[model samples]
Target: MDKIVSFCKRRGFVYQSSEIYGGIRSSYDYGPLGVELKKNIKDEWWRRLVHMRDDVVGVDSAIIQHPRVWEASGHTATFNDMLVESRTSGRRYRADHLIEEATEIDAEGLSAEEMTKVIREDERIKDPVDGGRDFTEARPFNLMFETYTGPVKGPENLAFLRPETAQGIFTNFKNVLDTSRVKVPFGIAQQGKSFRNEITPGNFIFRTREFEQMEMEFFVEPGTDEEWHETWIQERWDWYTGLGMDPENLRVYEHPPEKLSHYSKRTVDIEYDFPFAGWSELEGVANRTDYDLSRHAEFSGQKLEYIDQGTGNRFVPYVIEPAAGADRVALAFIVDAYREEELEGESDDSRVVLKLHPRIAPVKAAVFPLTKKEPVSTKARELYNDLRGDYSIFYDETGAIGRRYRRQDEIGTPFCVTVDFDTLEDDQVTIRDRDTMQQERVPISEVRERLQRLISTGSAAAER
Candidate 1:
C-alpha cells in the first residue's frame, strides 16, 4: 500500500486535498493523469452499459434531493452508523467497525444495543489514535447533512444532500416511464455524486464523504426478479474481466438474508483485491421487489405501475439494481494495472513500467526528439499535434532519448515515437515499444494508423 501511494504521488495521479494548508482529512483531488484515467473508466462503463446495449437508457439526476424523498425511502430514519468517542483522547470511531476489526468479522447487521453490549464486554475497543484509553459506549449517529432551504430557520423546509444516487432514480421512475414510453423489463441508469457525513472515511479514496456512483435500476416482471439479478451479476463480472483485470483478484459473494439490504430479497457483491484491504466490494447487484416504487407510490399518492397488454395485468415492476462506486472502480483499475519490472540491464539502465492497457492509459503515446535542436523538435512537435487531435500524446525534448523513454514507461504510454536525423533522409522514424523495448523504423506518415491498429487489436501489425 505504501508503494502504491508513493507511486501515485510521484507520478502525479492523485494528491491530498488542501495540501498547502496542512491537508484535509480523507479527501482527495485527482491530478492530470488521474482525471484522464478516471474519465476513461467512466466512459467505458457508459459505453458498455448504455450505448452498446439497446435495453438500457441513462439519465443524469440532481445531487440534492427533497427531504421527503429520504423519508419515503427510509434513509432519514435508517441511514446511520454506530459511533464511539474516546474518553481520554476525544477521538471518534465507527463502533461497529472497531468491533469488526478486533474480531476480523463484519458487524454491519448489528443493532445499536447489540453494538453497545459488545463494546462494553470487549476490552479491545481502545483508541486506535492514542492507543491507551478505552472508547465510550456505542450510540447511533445519523450520517446526513441537514440544512435549511429558505432564509428562516425552521424544521418545515429542511433539505439533505442525497446519500446515494439510487433514490433519485426511483423518485424519477414515473417521469422517465411517462416521457420515454419505456415498459417493463427496461432500465434507467444514472451517474451522480452523493454525500455522507461519515465518522471514518479512510482507506484513501476507497471510502469518502463525497463520492460518485454509477447506478442502474432494471425494472422487470415480479416473478423474473431473481433471474435478472443473476444476469446482471454475470454482466458486471464480465465487464470488469473484459477490461483486463486479473481473474484471480475478483470474486462474487452471495448475500444471505441477514446480510441483505432491508428492501432486497437477494444481493451479490462483486469484490476486488486492494493492497491496504484484502478484499472489498466494487459493486453490488440486488433484487429489490417493488420496495422503492411502492414506497414512492404510497408517499406521493401516485401510481407507479406498468400495465401488461397481453395478460391485462397492472402492477408495480420489480427492480434489479446494479450499483457501483465510481471512485472504487477507478482505484481497482489502478491497483490491478500497476506493474514493476526489472529490465535486462542492457547498459546498467534501470526502468519501471505501469503496464496499463492502452484503452485506459493516461497518455496513449509520447513523441520524442533525439535532440533539442530545431528540425528534430519541430518534426516531433508536428507529429504531436497530429496525434493529439485523436489521442492524448506527450511531447518531451528536454531530457535524453532514453530518459524520455523511461518517463513514458513510468506513465504507461505504450509506444514512443522518436524523430532523428534519419528522418531528414527518409521520412521514417524509430518507434520504441514500452513493454518489449523493441524498436522498429516506420514511415512517419503511418504513425497514426499504426497506433490506431495496435490500440484496437492490443498488438502491432507486422513492421508496416
Candidate 2:
C-alpha cells in the first residue's frame, strides 16, 4: 500500500489535496495519469452496465437533493456510525473500528452499547494515540454533510450532500419510467459524487469523506427479486475478475441477517484482498425489498409502483442494488497491477512495473525518439500527433531510451514506440511491449493499427 501510494504521487497519478497548504486529511486529487485511469474504469463500467444492456439506462443526478428525499429513504434517521473519542488525545474514532483493530473481530453491526461494553471489558484496546484507555461513551454520528440552500440558514432550508447515489436513482425512478421504454426488471444506473462525514476516514481512497459511486438500482417484481439479486452478484464478481483481478484475492461475504441494513432484505459484499486491510468490500449487492419505493410513495404521495399491462397487476418493484465506490476500485486496480521485478542479468537492478489491463492503462502507448536528432524527433512527434486523436499517447525525448521505457513502465503504459534513424529509410519504427520488453519493427502507418489490436485484446486475453 505504501509503495503504491508513493508510486501514484511520484508518477503523477494522484496527489494529496491541498498539499501546498499541508494537505487535507483523506482528500486526494487525481493527477494526469490518475484521471485517465479512473475515467477508463468508469467508462468500462458504463459500457457494460448501460451501453451494452437493453435493460439498463443511465442518469446523472445532482449532488444535493431535497432533505426530505433522505428522510424518505431512511438515511436521515438511520445512516450513522458509532463514534467514540479518546480522552487522552481528544481524537474521535469509529467504535466498531476500534474494536475491530483491537480484536480482529467484525464489529460493524454491533450497537453502540454493545461496542462500549466490548471496549470497556477489553484491556488490550488502548487509544491509538497516547495509549490511554480513557474514552467517551459510544454515540451515533450522522454521516451526511448538511448545508443550507438558497442563501437561507434555517432548518426548513437545510439540505445534504447526498451520502450515496442510490437515492438519486430512487427519486428519479418515476421520471425514468415515464421517459424511457424501460419497465420492471430494468435498471437505473448512476455514477456521481457522494459525500459522508466519516468519523475515521482512512485507508487511502478506500474510505473517504468524498467519493464517486457507480450504483445501479434494478427494479423487478417481488417474486423475481431473489433471482435478480443472485444474478447481479455473479455479474459484479465477473466484472472484477474479467478485468484481470485475481480470483484468489477476491471473495463474496454474506451479510448476516442481524447486520442487514434497514432497506436490505439480504446483502452480499464483493470483497477484494486489499494489502492494507485484508479482505474488504469492493462493492455491495443488496436486495432492497420495495422499501425505497414504498417509503417514497408514502412520504411524497406519489405512485411509485409498476403496473403490469398484461395481468393488470400493480405492485411496488423490489430493488436489487449493486453499489460500488469508484475510487476504491481504482485503488484496487493499482494495487493488483503493482510489481517489482529483478532484472534478468543484473541482480542489483530491478524495475517497478504496473501490469494494468491495456484497456484501462493511463497511457495506451508512448512515442519516443532514439535521440534529439532532427529526423528521429520529427518522425516520433508526427507519430505521436497522429495517434493522439485515437488514444492517450505520450511523447518523451529527454533521456536514454531505456530510461524512457522505464518511466512508461512505472505508469503502466502498455507499449512504447521508438523512432530511430532506421525509420528514415525503412519507414518502420520499433514497438516495445511493457511486460515482455520484446521489440518488433512495424511500418509507421501500421503502428496505430497494431496498438488498436493490442489494446482491444488487452495486455493478456481476459475473459469478458
For residues 125-219, could you state the per-residue lDDT of candidate 2 as single tens digits? Answer: 99988899998999999999999998778988989999999988988999998999887889999999999999999988888999999999999
> Which parts of model 2 have CA positions greater than 4 angstroms off?
104-106, 346-348, 460-464
TM-score of 2: 0.96
Model 1 is weakest, by summed lDDT over 10 consecutive residues, at 455-464
Candidate 1 — which residues are off by over 4 angstroms? 104-106, 459-464
**Cα error of candidate 1 at position 415, Å:** 2.3
Best by TM-score: 2
Highest lDDT model number: 2
Question: Candidate 1 at residue 406, lDDT?
Answer: 82
**Residue range 400-424, candidate 1, lDDT tens digits:** 7777888888888888989999997
TM-scores for candidates 1 onward, in order:
0.94, 0.96
Checking candidate 1 for backbone clashes, the offending pairs are none
Instruction: Point out the worst 10-residue segment of candidate 2 by lDDT.
Output: 455-464
Q: What local lDDT does model 1 show for residue 346?
A: 62
Question: 413 in model 1: Cα distance from truth in Å?
Answer: 1.7
